[model samples]
Target: MIRIVILLVTLVIGSVANINAQSKYEQGMGKAFALWTENKPFEASNVFERIAEVESEEWLPHYYIAMINALNSFGVTDKEKLTLQLEKAKKHIEEAELISPNNPEIIIIKATINTAWIAYDGATYGMTLSMKNAELYKKAFELAPDNPRVVLSKAEWDMGSARYFGQSIEPYCKDIERSLELFATFKAESTMHPSWGKDRAKEVLKQCKG
Candidate 1:
């Protein structure tokens, strides 16, 4: 009877341990995603670091960390600071790719990291990185063609690239027209989409003007 009781108790403890572990993993993933989606990268990075430690096999944490690092790199105008963050982002992104090579989101994120470099290089090297930026944005667009957010972001990047490449003077006006057209298209499509509505679209349009 004691043996039977001991065995049952062990089983219950094992089950409880498994549930706790799964709960921790899920909570970590959820927090990481929430922080990232909210654009709170510093907070997201902290959560992602915890997730990475807890679930090394899951690539999302590494991917988010890479994205945050890339954004931070772009936020700075200092070349050395930008390069250091870019390298860090590259490392994390490479690890994520290793974990999930075929993941579409990972591909887009890899392209995002490249965009930061493109922006930085543009500041330092004139138009040298403009083509590179266009190429990465195109790759991202191809990778996630159906995602409304991705489509909108790609169009915006193209508009920036057009200006950076000095194609903005068509006589000057044509580039502006194209940029406005793309922005309008994105605004309409993103706003009307069932999942994402008009408010964010209006904010984006306001940004375009300013």
Candidate 2:
């Protein structure tokens, strides 16, 4: 009876420790996200990279590292700097893929990174990068057709294409609207899970309306 009681106490202590660890991780992620939402991608990326280094078993940190790099690359005007950022984004995304190969979020980020490269210098890398980006997007959709992040990525891509070609953005606006609806109802599997892209979808939806 004493042994059983001891075992029960140990289990309870272990569970509490686990809960505290998870809460700490969520707090770190919240800090990173706050920086990201404030348009501090460089700082957010650093936070994410640190998290990835410490939580080698998790894929979300690596995914966010790639995402922040990709988002920051857009504002970079220096060709050399942009190229380096894109490469870093690609490397981090690849790391994320190793951790979660079938993850829709990782797949969509891969598509986004490749698309960013094409947008950066289409004259030199357009054909191949565009093909690869489209393939990644298709794979992501196949993997998780109902995922809000996947739908948002596709909608954003369509909006970019429309703008590049000087075409109407109305169709893509509808896509964004649908994605926002999904985002509203979407439930993440865990607090540590990827639950971004909703705010981004709303931002793009506003731009499309504008």
Candidate 3:
């Protein structure tokens, strides 16, 4: 009887410890996200890196780190700086991929990174990375067609391609509408999982004709 009581007490203590650990992780990630939302990319990235150090088994922190790098690379006038930044992002992405192979989120972010390079200098990267980016987007769709982020990303890329060639953007506008619909009812696997791209979709929708 005493042994059983001791065992029960140990289990309760372990459970409480787990709860406290999870609470700490949530707090850290929440602060990181707030910083990111506030335009403090460096601070947010630092916090995410720290969290990743502690949450070695979790892929979210690495994902956010890569995402920050990818987003920051945008509009960078210095090609060399952009290359270095994206290279770091690729390292974080590799870490995340190791933890969660073939993840839709990871795949989409890889495509985003490639897109950043293409946007920076299409003449240099388009021939090499364009095909890979398209493949990554296609694979992400196949893996998680219901994922709003994937839908938004793929549709947005198509819209950009259409506008580049003076083609109609009407077709991809419908896909963006579909992404918005998915976002409306989408449920993330956890609070830590991604739930972005809704606002991006809304902004893109502004370009669509009524």
Candidate 4:
């Protein structure tokens, strides 16, 4: 009877520890995201890198590092700086993939990284990077046909191609509209989950309408 009582107490303690860890993770992620949304990519990346190191089992931290770097690469004009950022983004995305293989969100991040690279220097990389980007997008879509984040990623890619590579925007307008609809109904599984991309989707929709 004493042994059973001790076991029950241990279980309760373990459960409490697990809940505390989750709460801490969520709070850290919230601060990191606030920095990111405030246009502080370097600060946000630092926070995310720390989270990724501490929470090695969680893939979201690594994914955010890649996503932030990729987004920042768009606004960077220095060739060397852009290359460095892209390399870091690739490394983080690769790590995230190792942690969560075949995950739809991770796949989209991989695609986004490649898309950003191609956008930065498509003239030099030519069709190879473009082909790989398309392949990754196709793989992600196959993995999660109804995922709102996937839809948003694909729509953003389409719009980017139109803006930078002179591709027609008409075909992607429907996709942008669909992504907006998807975003409206999307709900993240948890605070630490991938809850971004909706606001970006709204911006894309506006651009499409314009």
Q: Write the per-residue lDDT of candidate 3 for residues 1-210, one digit (tens) a residue.
A: 223223322322222222222578888887776676555766888998999999999998898888778877877879789888899899999999999999999998898788888878899898788889889989999999999889988998788778878999998988999999998998877666777667667877988964
Q: What lDDT does the true structure give each of the candidates?
A: 0.55, 0.73, 0.79, 0.71
**Which should have the higher TM-score, number 2 or number 3?**
3
- lDDT of candidate 4 over 1-210, digit per residue (tens): 223223322322222222223478777777776665555667978998998989998888888788767766774669899889889999999999999999988887787667666667777774788778778888888998778778767766666667677777778878767876886887766655665555556666777677
The best candidate in terms of TM-score: 3
lDDT of 1 by residue, 1-210 (tens): 223223322322222222222467666656655554554656867887777877878786687678667756655778788787778788888888888775555655666666666556646544555555566557656775655544545555555555656764223233233434443544322211112212333444544556
Instruction: Give the TM-score comparing model 1 with the true structure, all chains together.
Output: 0.60
| TM-score quality measure for candidate 4 | 0.78
By lDDT, is 1 or 4 better?
4
Between candidates 3 and 4, name the one with more favorable TM-score.
3
| Model 2 segments more than 4 A misplaced | 1-24, 34-39, 162-173, 199-210
Give RMSD to native, each candidate: 15.3, 12.7, 12.9, 12.8
As for candidate 2, its clashing pairs are none
Q: Give the Å error, residue 199, model 1.
A: 6.2
Error of 1 at 5 (Å): 59
Error of 3 at 101 (Å): 1.1
Q: Each prediction's TM-score against the native?
A: 0.60, 0.75, 0.85, 0.78
> Local error of candidate 4 at 146, Å?
0.9
